[model samples]
Target: MTTAERIAAAPTGTETAGHPGPLAYPAARAAGCPFDPAPAVDHARREQPVTRATLWDGSPCWLVTRHQDVRDVLGDPRFSAEATRPGFPFLTAGLRELITSTSSSLIRMDDPEHARLRRMLTADFMVKKVEAMRPDVQRLADDLVDRMTDGRTSADLVTEFALPLPSLVICLLLGVPYEDHDFFQERSRVLLSLRSAPEEVRTSSDELFDYLVRLAESKQHEPDDGIVSRLVARGELDFEEVANMGRLLLIAGHETTANMTALSTLALLRNPAQLAKLREDPSLIKGAVEELLRYLTIVHNGVSRVATEDVTIGGQTIPAGEGVLCTINTANRDDAVFPGGDTLDVSRDARRHVAFGFGVHQCLGQPLARVELQIAVETLLRRLPGLRLDVPFEDVPFRHDMAIYGVHSLPIAW
Candidate 1:
């Protein structure tokens, strides 16, 4: 059956003959506390770490909420990441349509294919390679701060600093023109929005794919140092394959870091003591970045996988073909791994977070993300010592509607 048909035919509500109704997956976060995982998620982690939950289509899936269990599910090869597989859970119909309609990237593939594609770009994001770019990232951060602060005491950090910093860096890496950022950024927003319809997702994805394909074709004629150019030079991947990889890198490279930058800044602002502590000790920035990643865990919706064979997780046996959602946000808050997990502590040792995920599919660009965030956050604090919210805390618009959680707009004055 088609995805639409499956969703349409799925049972309504979580009611079952002999069991309690499953809690709704992607439960709403409390109004004032945007940083915490949904209370329902936290409660599930504490009370029922492994339990049934209903997706947007009322499809039942296993929700694994504990830290160890989350790692087990993601680490076990028995759980597949292939979205096209039967019973693979998707957060929204639009996402399902988007993934299945497009050529699969590393994130959407399994096994040798995933590893093969991943190895092609592994050198680009290696810790040493990314660290070498730290100077460049630092320079960019300083330049952006200069631009944002020139004759301006206040600015919307999201537009002026947070978004543009990583967008510029990724554009440089991908060889895409920074001038076309508006074109891609708008489309990316739509692609990431849970509220977007399947048609909207399709249109946006198609435009991006076409754009990347054209860019790759251009690179074939006159190559550059960027990733797309290198891939075109290799001659191993066709234009469409290159485009698929490019699309994934381009969207993921910018969006995730941008959100983390803005959200981390907001988080630090909310925790004055933590901010003060970091300012007093510059060396703490690295650990602080890890702590922020752990505390925020911005991939608010859990990662999805389908069990390929019967496997026990958290004392529950998930049969082959069953869907599983690993709530990393709740896992990050698992008290066993992180004591006092909800509170933000810059000095806390939070290096073991699953924020970047776990096992083979762990974020490939994590090294770059860490450097970008470290520079972005540190530069903001150092350059703008007087930074404070321009609007009241209550007036800040949070991105609850989007699949990724962050502040929609962060107005600040220094």
Candidate 2:
């Protein structure tokens, strides 16, 4: 049966119906199942993987939950990512306002503009280039672990090691001084926060833009071996575009990786058997990373898209101008695609997971992110042989209010 038909015929009082409405776009995670997607997401995947949904602004759209359906929506060019589009699904009014008020970056633009701008920065994140930096990444990971474990029986892994590794790496990659990490990190938190006040979001965005503007301009006069300096030297993009690009890279580069580091570590600690297996065989690190990403799928929100043409998928017709929320979290957790999907099995072949997303907009920094995560995970377990959570797993604070999902402060003791 078609997904919509199935949903309509199914029993009532499902989690979807218990909400503000049956089609609420943003669903909440199950109380005890913090790592899994919301019960609503799971319900959708099982009974009606592609069904109608109501966005935050009371706009109706299609919520795609199945793995292949999400792939179809995201990979198809008819679906646009432009935030300025009339029916684009925005998570918050603050985010919509921020996008409209500022110059668009690579994430907001479609190809060939997206391709052109992305081309300017791709060289730095290419697998070979990032692979060559493994020594540096490993060194940084070791140094942070040394500091985190030294003179302290316990540490907030979020701030001590997880947050700093990627922040420092991105700073070096972008030519921004490592000393200014606190400045950007705080502003980024405000910007990514789902609960930030409108004024706070606006101020943080403007401040970040202004900082990038100065940094990009300075690079013109004095070139450095950073991504921003190289883009500035290219001279193809204007000052505003360059600054926006820098802002996008700076915020996105670190935030996602940082969250993954912290969350993945927490997941491992919780799954002691998996942690022991990984510890026993260092060769499993690559597959373990993929499994953790699939299990956590930290980017809780789907990658938003606006339909530009009428399309039919899973027997539901999505008309032009409607929004589509390709719920990645659900797709990754899909039981059909990955057997025993909810359970974390580090040795599973999870290479097909969409944790980095898919299609042309797939994460450009996947290579760098993979390298950093591998090093960080390996170093943490190798260095702190008896690492475990200091606080009760239930007591660990989660970033449910932020666009990215992760632990706020993971207290660790070895």
Which predicted model would earn the best lDDT? 1
For model 2, the superposed segments whose C-alpha errors exceed 4 Å read 1-21
Every candidate's lDDT: 0.91, 0.86
True-structure RMSD, every candidate? 4.0, 4.2
TM-scores for every predicted model: 0.95, 0.95
Best candidate, TM-score-wise? 1
Cα lDDT tens digits for candidate 1, 321-395? 999999999999998999999999999899989999998999999999999999999999999999899999999
What TM value does model 1 have?
0.95
TM-score quality measure for candidate 2: 0.95
